[model samples]
Target: MNNQHETPEQKRERLRQEELKKNPIGTLKDGFNGNGNLADLVGSLGWKGTGILIVVLIVGYVFYKLFF
Candidate 1:
């Protein structure tokens, strides 16, 4: 077995190549679509919906504090 240490530039290049493999089109395409329409399939009971719920809660709390 042999151990090798990569220079900073070499390590960065390797990481960039790995990122390209994971997202060739950059951020335009959603890679997780292989499973299906994640939103419809998983329903609205997920982090997406939960995030909206949290925003609403925060706004409501602010309004309550401001008005009453």
Candidate 2:
């Protein structure tokens, strides 16, 4: 709990755990910024979520191209 007392490895692990608790939007931003692995993010979403996301993206792209 005390950063000053933590060894480098402990500090790194604490930070890693904190990063893992980020919300989906934060994770998405981190992925876009290249600070996080997108594969990990997609893996967290699982197949159902991944499928829905893809469908939504395709529909949005089609709608955008059709309207604007």
> What TM-score goes with each of the models?
0.35, 0.51
Q: lDDT score, residue 35, model 2?
A: 80
Clashing pairs in 1: none
Candidate 2 displacement at residue 21 in angstroms: 11
C-alpha root-mean-square deviation, candidate 2:
6.4
Put down candidate 2 lDDT per residue, 1-68, tens digits, no spaces: 77789999998877665665666567666766788786656754658878998999999999999999
Steric clash count of candidate 2: 0
Q: List the global CA lDDT of all models.
A: 0.55, 0.74
Each prediction's total of clashing residue pairs, residues at least 3 apart in sequence or on different chains, is: 0, 0
lDDT of 2 at 46: 56
